[model samples]
Target: MSATSKKILVVNRKSPYGGLRSREAIDTLLVASAYGLQVSALYLDDGVFQLIQSQQADQINSKNIARMISAFEMYDLKEVYVDASSMGKRGIQQQDFVIPVEILTTEQIKTLLHQQDQILSF
Candidate 1:
C-alpha cells in the first residue's frame, strides 16, 4: 500500500438481492483494495441484510453474497461497518452477521463519510 493511497468509502444502501448494486459494491471494494487503496464499506438501510448469516442464494440461483462477505478480511478490506439504527430497525444484532463488523451510529457514519477521499454509493 502506498503511504498516500486514497481513502475510499463504498456505501451499500440497497437490499442485496433486489438487483446487483450490493454485489457490485462489494466487487468495487475488493478491486479498490487490490489496487492498494484504503477501502472501507458502510452498510446502510436494507444493505444491512447483506451481512446476515445463512443466506440461501442457491435457492434463487444467484451467487452467495454471505460467503463473499466473509472473504473481506482476506482481501485486506478490514474497515467494514454497519449502521446501528438500521440493524435495530431490522432487529439484527452483531451475532446475526456472518462476519465481524464495526457498528456505527448515523452521526459516526457521517463523520466517517467526511473523512474519506472518495465516496461511492452502490
Candidate 2:
C-alpha cells in the first residue's frame, strides 16, 4: 500500500476462456488485490456473459472461469460492475448473473474510469 490507496479498474470485454482476455483481466485484479490496492472489475460487451450463472465450460474443455470470479469475495475485491445496455442487448436480466453487480450506463462507466488511479482493459 502507498500513502494513499490506489484505485485500479479492470475492464473485461470478452467471454471467459474465449481467448486470454478475460483470464488476464481477472489475474490482474487478483494481483492488485493481493497488493492491497482498491480494485474494481467491469464487464462490457460479451464480457457480461462471464458472470452468468451455470456456465458449462466442460463441453469446450475450458477451465471454469466462474470459479475464479467467485474468489473475488475472498480477496475482498467487491466492486463488480456491468454495462446496463450490454446486459439488455444480451437479454441478461439482473437475476441472470451469478453475483449481484452494479449496472452502469456508458457515461457512468466513463466516470468510473476517470476515478481510477490505473485502468487496464482486456
Candidate 3:
C-alpha cells in the first residue's frame, strides 16, 4: 500500500537537548503527516521529556521545539503515546506534558508498535 494508506509511528528516544534526534523526529512526523500519512508519536525513555513544559533550550543555545510539537493537532496527527514505565522511572507525571498524551504500558506499546505499518525511530 502507499505511504498515505499505511500507518506510520514515530518513535522518539532521545533527550530534548544534547542532540537533535528529538527535533528531527518531530520534523519528520510533521512532514509525514502533512503528506496525509497516518502518523502517531510514541515517546519512550528520554523522548518523553520532549513534551515537558518551560524548557530552557536557550540555556544551551538550542532552539525551542514547543511550537513544532504544538502543531501536531493542526497536522491531524494521531495519538501521542507515552511509556508509563518511562514516566515512572523519570518521575514525570502526565500533567508534566505540555500536550495531552495517552499513557501506555510496556505490553501495550509492544502491541501498538507491532501493529504499525512503518516505524521511524530517532
Candidate 4:
C-alpha cells in the first residue's frame, strides 16, 4: 500500500432500498478503492439488509445494491464486515448474507473503529 493509502471504514446504517444512502456508501467504497485507499465496509442496523441475498430490485425499479455488492471483489474492495449484535437482533444468519462478511463482536467493532484512519458513515 502507498503512504497515501488511507485505511477507511465506510459505515452503513440505513435500510437498503429505502433511500440513496446505501447506494452512496457503495459508490464511495468503489471510488475509494479505485483511488488506492484500503477500504472496508461495516454494516449495522438496517444496513445489514443490504447484504441479504436474492433481492429483486427490478420489481421496485431500483438499482440492485445486492448485485453491486457481489462485485466488490472485482473492485478490490474486500474486508466487508457486519456487527454481530445487529445480525442477531435481525435474526439473520451468517449464511443468509449474499456476500461473505466478517461478523464482528462489539469489542472487535470498537477495535476496528480505532484502527481506521478515516470513517465515512452512510
Q: How close is every model to the real structure, measured as TM-score?
A: 0.94, 0.93, 0.95, 0.94
Q: Write the per-residue lDDT of candidate 4 for residues 1-122, one digit (tens) a residue.
A: 56457689999999889999999999999888888878899999999999998788999999889998888989977799999999999999999888889999999999999999989999
Model 2's TM-score against the true structure: 0.93
- The list of candidate 1 runs beyond 4 A from truth reads 1-4
lDDT of 1: 0.90
Q: What overall lDDT goes with each candidate model?
A: 0.90, 0.88, 0.89, 0.92
How would you encode candidate 2's per-residue C-alpha lDDT over 1-122 as one tens digit per residue?
57238888899999877798888888998988888888899999999999987889899998778878988889888899999999999998999887769999999998999998888889
Error of 1 at 17 (Å): 0.7
Can you write out model 1's per-residue Cα lDDT over 5-120, one digit (the tens) per residue? Answer: 77889999998799999889989988888777889999999999999987999999999888888889889888999999999999999999988899999899999999988899
Model 3, which residues run further than 4 Å from truth? none
Stretches > 4 Å off in candidate 4: 1-3
Error of model 4, residue 110, in angstroms: 0.4
**Residue 93's lDDT in candidate 3:** 95
Better of 1 and 2 by lDDT: 1
Better of 2 and 3 by lDDT: 3
